[model samples]
Each structure stands twice: as structure tokens, then as C-alpha cells.
Target chain A: MSIFFSLFAGLGLFFIGIRLVSNNLRQVIGRRLRQLIARAVTGAGSLALFGLLAGAVMQSVNAVIHVLVSLVTAGAMDRKRAFPIIRWANIGTSLLVLVAAIDLHALALCLVGLTGIAYYQQIDQSTRWRHAVGALLGLGLLFLGTDFIKSGAALLRTEPWLRLHISELGLWLLPSFAIGAAVAWVAQSSTTVVVITMSLAAGGLISWNGGTMLVMGAGLGSAVSAWNLAGRLQGSARQLVLFQVLLRLQGLLLTFIFYACNRWLLDDPFNRLLDHFQLGLPARFAAFYMVVQLLSDLGSRTLEKPSLRWLEAWAAPSLQENLSKPHFVHDEALDEAETALLLADKEQQRLLACLPAYLDALRQDAPAALASADKRQAAESQVLQLCEQFLVELADRQRSRDVLERSMVLRDRNRLLGSLQESLAELHQSTRAVMSDPTVAQLLDHLVQSLHIVLETLAETAALAQPDAEELELLRSLTHDRSDLMDSIRRRLQGSDLEPGLRQAVFSATTVFERCVWLARRYVLLLDGPAASPDHPK
Target chain B: MSFEHDINDEQGTRLVSLKGRIDSATASAFEQATQDLFATPNARALLDFSAVDYISSAGLRVVLMAAKRAKQAQGRLLLCGMRQHVREVFEISGFLQIIDSVADRSEGLRQLNA
Candidate 1:
């Protein structure tokens, strides 16, 4: 009971330590991880090498693979680079097995003490130092936990019933293999299973052949674990996990054939080599594990190309893949300031193109109920919000004076357009309530007709390279005339015996109408240059 | 938009208080409510614009139209309690030139009766 308690406590502490280190390290790295991948990794070889280093530093190949998956999803790295990186990350898992084999309690304790003092002193106030300390603490806890697990497991040698059961199971390779695989799956760490198998074999409880079968099962167990995990993932991530499973299966097949053929070989050359070297069973088992890993990685070199092709072909991106990405932002335009400005201008024009459609929606006959009008307004708001997002993204780009000026104009224009649309939507809602008032209804109809004219002129002028002075004058005159028209409507309503609600409806509709013309005039002035602005008053 | 009008005396000096947004939609109501004030006997109109939040060009045009009519009737159109932003709209559109403005109701009445 004590042994079982210690074992579970150790496993719990191990998982917590790993999770703590991974999460904190990710925060410490933050966006620099993407920057590092961009700068340090160029080709497949470098990417693989970097992946190995990242896995070793992070202490979890699975964690490293998840980072790669995120990078791919963010469109920060291509799938081609991710494939090699994933391969090397898988190779890097061997480091954990190697570390677990040797006792690092003393070194881990030293690091813990050093980081503890550093943390106490607040030597570096940055999050980077804090994360480093956390990682050291996690490493120390992992070392301590492993020691507890090993000590607890050592007691199993004294239990005769367990030994008898193990011996009975060890008589058949398949059952022993399955038992090893099952243990690894439960622990979610094949390294733990391999270490236990090595300890059992070295203690003279399990034979060398039984240890080999257990190691073989550990490989399949890892594959099963990855497949179970990858089942929930999509795109390049799922493909990489699938590839990992296939690679493990390949290793399992090779190991099984070697085990079967060794029975007929003279004196079992593998065991003879371990005996001749006077190495312990633990070292011998570790050596076999590494050889299998190396062989699999080497064999997988030829499979990489076809595997990547298959992944790409199978996980063909959907059309909506681009929905999350900015449609107007092209990477090539970012290199040149002028080109970027031009692209932003084009994007602004695209937003303006939506103006006609928005106006058309407003011009349509009133809906049957208030709820439908609200729904239509909500949908229109979302579309306008998307345009605003795009405009904001464009505004964030670095630009020179000319481009900067243009961006400012476009940003202001976008804002005013959004305001105008909001007012129009409000007017539509009020128009519905006041539809029974013939005076209000007629005024709304006339307002809508006038708005259409203003919008068409604005849209046409936006498309021109330079709006002629006469055209600019005409727009300004129309703006003045619209203001007068609204005033006359106000005067007419004031002379009538209309109810307050009907009068208020006409006022709100006229507000949007006058502002639309004002906005058009402002935009025309913006195009005509700062000197022609109404604020300056030509 | 709303209009709260009070007749100060038998001489018919009217105090008209406006609130909320006065744009094209509400301008008609505003004009309708205030148009009759200037027509009253011995009428001197004082409009309070402090609570008004915004005025589009349409609203400014109504103010200008009222000012012109008040002047024609030999009645004063005095605006008081204008919010800074709303006042700026009036100033920018040159509506301040068309109507007399005072700081508050007392000042507006003093100016209108003067």
C-alpha cells in the first residue's frame, strides 16, 4: 500500500512538473518563439536541428510539436518546414529516456538551490528570469519524484506473488508486450515504462528477452498515445500525429522480426555483446531502445516527401481557410511603403463599394415587423465591423508622409461612413414606427431618394483620379441644397398639426440625410486637397 | 428631440427649451414647435440649447430659417445655454451670424427684451 501511494504521488508530481515547465516556458518565450523560428530555421535540416534543441530545452517533444502546430495555424510557418521540425522533435524524445536513465538528483538539486536564491534576490525582474526559475523548480521536482518512484518500484522485487505472475506473463512475448504498452499508455510516458522495465531486468526479475519485448510494446504505446491525442486535432497537426503513429508501427514491425529471428541465431549476438561489455541490463536496454529510434528516424528520411505529399493532399484547405486571414493585406506590398499605401487605398475603395449595397438595403421597402428590422441592422453592423477591422489593420502599417496622409483621410472617411450607417439604421427603425404618418412617410421617401443620389455621386467621385472642380462644386452645391431641403421639410412640419412622434421621426431621418451629404462633401474636399476644405471655407 | 415652451408674460416672451439630438429627423418637430412662438403678440423668443447634444446641417438650417423669419416679424430670436460642441456647429456653419446668442436664459431674455 505504501509503495502504491508513493508511485501515484510520484506520477502526479511528475505530470505537474512537466505541465508547469511547459506552460511557463511558453509564456516566457511568447512571440519570440515565432521570431526565433523565422530567423534560425531556413531549410529542412536546420528546422529539424532547431526542433531537437527546442524539444530538449522544453523537455517535451509533444509540447514542441504543439508549438509547431500553432505556428502553422497562425500562418507564421509553412507545413513543409513543420514536417521536418516534427520529425526532429520526435527524435528528441530520446533525450528524456537518456536523462531518466542516469540519476540527476544531485544536479537537479543544485539547480533548484541556485534558482531559488536567484528568485529570492529578485536578481532579474523580468518574466524571463521568473520562468527560468519555475523551469528549474519543475526539473528539481521531477528528479525528486523519479527517485521516489524508483525506490518504491524497488520493493516489487521482494513480492513473490508479483514475481510469479510476471514470470508467468513473461513466458509469452505478446502478453508481456501488451502489458508494457498498457502501462505506458496509462502513464502517458513511454520513458517511465522503459525505465521500469530496465530496473526490473537489472534486478534479475525479468530476462533480457522479456525486457526487449516490453521496450517494443513501449514504442506502440507511444504511437497509440499520439494517435489518441491527434484525433482531436486538424490539418497539418493531425497529419504529423498520424505520421508519428505510422513511424512507431514501422519500428514495432522491425523489432518483432528481429526478436523472432534471434531465436534461430547462434548464441544470440545481441546478448553476447552486452555480456562481453560487462554492462548492466539497464544500459543494455537503453542501447537497444536508442538503436531502434535511430533506425526508425533514418528509415523515415525517405518517407518524409511522400508523407508530406499525402498530408497536403488529404488535408486540402477549405475555402473558408482564408476567412480568418486578412484578404487585402499582401505580403509583397509590405516591403514597399508606396505599394502598401496603394493597397490600403484599394481596400478603402472596396469598403466604399459596399456603400451602394448598404444604401440599397436601406432604400428597400420597410419590413413587416420590428424584429426583422433589428436583425437586418445587426447583420449590417457585422459587415461594417469587418470593414472597420480591415481599415484598422491598414492604418497600423508604417507609412511615409504622403501615404500617412492618405491613410488618415481613409480612416476618417471609414469612421464617418460607419456613423452615417448607424444613423441610417436608426432612421429605418423610427421610420417603421412612424409609417402611419403620411407626412413622415413622404418625407422619408424623399430623404431616401436624395441619399441615393448623394451616394452615387460620392461613389463615382471616389473612382476618379481627380474630381474636376465643376464636379466638386456640384457636390458642394448638392450638400448645401440638401441642407436647405431638410430645413424646408422642418419648416413645413412645424406649420402642420403633426404629433410629436411623427415630427421626431422626420427629424431623425433628416439628420442622417444632411450628415450623408455633409460626409460626401467632406470626402470630395479631402480629394480636392486641404485648401478646398469647408473648414477653410473657399 | 423635445420642446418645452413657457410664456413669460402677457406680452408673450417665450422661453423654449430643446433637448436631445436635433438632426434632420427631429428638425421638423423642432421647427414646428418653435414656429408658432414668433407668431404670438409682442413675441420675443429665447431658445435654450444646453441639453441638445448634436445638430447636423439640417438642424442648423432650421435655426437659420427661424432666425430669418423672427427678424422679418420684428421679433428677436435669442439662443441661450448652447453646449460648446453644438455651439461650434452653429459657429462653423455661420449660423451664429444669423441669430443672437446669450450665455443663459436670463441673459437671453435681457438681450431679447433689450
Candidate 2:
């Protein structure tokens, strides 16, 4: 009973430590980590190094993949750039399993002592070092947990009842592998399972061959966990998860082949090679885990292209994702400042064309909106942001004053477009909210129709190569101030016998409409150029 | 809802009278009814909305599209005989300022003829 208690306590401490370290360390690194990921993709090599670094810090490839998925979704890092990093992170996660091979009882004591003092001295409450302190405490707990697990396994090995069962279990390779896979799936971390297996092997509770099967099974189990974790993810995010799963399967297959050769034909060359290092059973198992990860990484590299194609077919990007990506701006265009600016303008024009789709849900005559307003809005915002980044890059590279001035104007217009999209989305929601009210149905219908016309006109005018002065004047008139009309609607609502929620909806809808009109006018003035609008400040 | 329309040409002006509800279900026919009003260059037309009790956003969209086509063709379009509810729809949308309208058919015809 005491032995079972010790094992359970050790596992509890280990999981708690992992959770503490992963969650807080990310907070400690924060935006600098994200900035590094966004800006440092010079090539595959740098991406792999960063991926390895991320895996080592987080100690779980699953956690690292989650971070990469978010970055990909946000357009901060391309999925193609993230692929190599994910492959290498699998190897990097072996760092913890390797570290666990060596006994660190003294080091664990020192860490516990130091962090205890820090906690007593209130250092953990210091904002600057709080996460760092927590991470150190987690490291100490992790080491202590390792010590407890090793001692518990050593005690359990002396039991004749356990010895009889384990020896019988080790004789059947499939059972050993099945046990490891089941435990790993439950733990959601193969490293945890492998480390526990190492303790059992060192204590003479399991054979080296059994440990090898367990390690391979743990890899497969972790892959399953990743797939389950990514159940809600879509597009390239799902592709990354599939990539990770394939990488694990590839490693498992290679390791099984090597195991078969060693067991049947080759006079145990695999174990013989590990025997050359003079490592104990625990270190040997750790070495075996590392070799499997390395084999997976190497196998994945040779098959990377075809594997990516397969993943793409399996999880093709959704329409929203394709829409969100910038179609015109590319990094190669940045070398030629004028071309880059032109491409940015073209992308902005595309975004403008998408604006009227926000009201498609409210339009009875139109086909169903391509996506929900929020999703479409987010997609447009993503493209607008990319265009802004391209323009900023152009400005930085060009020393010519004329180029810089034009870039600045484009940036201003990009901001106005963002504001316009936001207002239109809000108006859509508010109008929808009141559309069912019998008293205000006609009013809501009119608002939707009027806004739709202005949006379509604005989009059309902006698409022209050089919008004539007459067309520009027409846009200006169409988007001119309608504050009086909105105010009259509000006053009528205030005096009407309507429910408070419906009344507020009407007021909110009118206010957003007014803002949408103002934003459209500002955009038109920007389109007309600063010289043409003396009354509006640049 | 149900909608019906009648189109007549008086001299150079085209007059259309609409009845029933102009909504999503009937907006297509409403649009089809006025398609030929601007077939000729600089055409003049009047739409009477007294018999129409309700106009939904879809119906308004068809009306807005017709007005834009008329402007593009360099033609004149006038709306008249709008019931109280229909006129409120126009006024609230700010379309009253962009498209010309009047209280009754006689005024709309006089304006178009003059």
C-alpha cells in the first residue's frame, strides 16, 4: 500500500510541476517569444533551432505545436515555416527524458531549498520574477518526483508477487507495448510514461526489450493525444497536427523494424551499439527513446514534400482561411518599393470588395453570406494587417521622400478601412437584433437596404483605376452626414411605446450607421487625395 | 406576400402602379416589371406606391437598383402616391434626398412632363 501511495504521489507531483512550468514560463517569455517566432524565420535551419528551443523549454512537443498553431492562425508565421520546427521539436522533447536518466537527488534538494527560501522571502510575489520563481519551484518538484518514483520502483521490485507478474508480462512484447500505450494515452505525455518505464527498468522490474516496446508504444499514444487535442482546430492548424501524428508513426515503424532485426537476425546490433556507451538500464532506455525520435525526424525529412501534400489534401484550407491570406503582397516584392506599394494597394482594394459581404446575412435577395460576419470581419482584418506590414516594409527600405509620403497615405487609408469594417459589422448585428420587432421591421429593412447600396457603391468606386472626379463626388454625396436623419429616428424611438431592448437596438443601429457613413466619407477623401479636400485635414 | 404591377406609357412618361406587399417573395417580379422602363435613352418614369402596404429590404434593394440604372441611362425617375408606411421607409433610409418623390400621381406626372 505504501509503495502504491509513493508512486501515485510521485506522478501527481510530476504532473503538477509540468503544468506549472509550461503555463508560467510562457507568461514570463510573453511577447518577445512571439516576436522571435514571427521575425526569425530566415530559413529552415533557424526555424528548427527555434522549434527545438521551444520544445526544450516547454518539455512537450504537444504544447509547442499548440503555440505554433496559434501563430499560424494569426498570420504571424506561415504554416510551411512551422513544419520543420514541429519535426525537430519531437527530438527536442527528449531532453527531459534524457535528463531523467541521471540521479539528481542532491540537485533536487538544493533547488527545493533555494526556492523555499525565495517563497518565504516573498520573491514569488515580485512581478518581474514571479513566473521564473514558479518555474524553478516546478523544476525542484519534478526532480523530487523522479526520486520518489525511482525509490518506489526499487521497493516494488523486491516483492515476489510483482516480480512473477512483471516477468510474465515482459515475455509477451504486445502486452508490454499495450500497457505503455494505454498509460501514455491517459497521461497525455509520452515523456512521463517513458521516464516511469526507465525507473522500472533500472530497478530490474522490466527487461530492456520490454522498455524498447514501451517507448515505441508511448510515441504512438502521444500522437493519439495530439489528434484528440486538435479535434476543434481547422485548416492549416489541423494539418500541423496531422504532420505530428505522421512523424510519430514513422518513428514507431522504424524502431519496430530495428527491434525485429535485433531480436531475430542481427545478433542484437541495436542493443550492442548502446552497450558500447556503458550506460545503465535507465540511461540505455533514455538513449533508446532519443534514437527513436531522431529516426522519426530523419524519416520525416526525406518524405516531407509528399507528406505535406497528403496533409493538405486531408485538411485543405477553408474558404475563410484562403480569403484571409494576402493575395498580392509577397516578401519578394519588398525589394522594389514601388511594386510592393502597388501590390499593397491591390490587396486593400480586394479587402474593400469584401466589405459589403458583411451585410449579406441581412440581405434577403443576396445569397447566404460567405461566412458569419465575425469570421468575414476577422478575415478582412487579417488581410488589411498584412497590407499594412507590406507598406511599412516599403517605407523602411525606401529613402525617397515621395515614396515615404505615399506609403503614409496608404497606411492611413488602411486604418480607415479597418474602422469602416468594424462599424458595418456592428450595424449588421444591431439591425438583425431589431429586425423581428413589428414596430421597427420596416425601419430596419430600410437601414439594411440603404447601407447595402452605399457599401456596394463605395466598393465599386474604389475598384476603379483612376476614379473620375464626378464618381468621387458622387461617393462623397452618398456618404455625406446623415446625423439629422439618425437623430430623428432616435427621437421617434424615445417617444414610441417600444420595449427597452428593442429601443436600445434601434439607437445602437443608428449610431453605428452614422459612424459607418463618416468612415466611408473619410475613405473617399483619402481616395480623392489631400489636394482635392482642403476642408478635411490630412 | 403577393404583389402585382401594371405598367403604362402616357406620351413619353412610363407610369407603373404597384399593389400588395413588396417583399423577398415578390421582389423579383417587382424588379422584372420595371426592367424596360429605362430601355430608351433619357426615359421618364413614375412609380405609384399607394396600393403597396409593406416594402422589405429586398424590395427596397430592387427599387435602389432601378434608380441607379435610371441615373446611369441619363433618365428621370419619380416616385409618388406612397402610403404613410412606405413614405416612412423612404424617409428613414435617406433615399428621399437621393431619389425624387412626390405626394401623388398628378404632381409626379406634372414634374415628369414639365
Pairs clashing in candidate 2? none
Each candidate: what lDDT? 0.63, 0.78
Q: Where in model 1 is the C-alpha error above 4 Å?
A: A1-33, A99-164, A261-278, A317-321, A326-538, B1-114
Compose the digit string of candidate 2's lDDT tens values, residues A266-378: 89876778778878998988988888888899779878989999999989988788888888987778898767777777777788888878888876656878787877787
Top-scoring candidate (lDDT): 2
Instruction: Rate residue A328 of model 1 by lDDT.
Output: 61
What value does the lDDT take at residue A312 in candidate 2? Answer: 92
DockQ of predictions, in order shown: 0.02, 0.34
**Sliding window of 10 residues with minimal summed lDDT for model 2 chain A:** A529-538
Question: Which 10-residue span in candidate 2 chain B carries the lowest summed lDDT?
Answer: B89-98
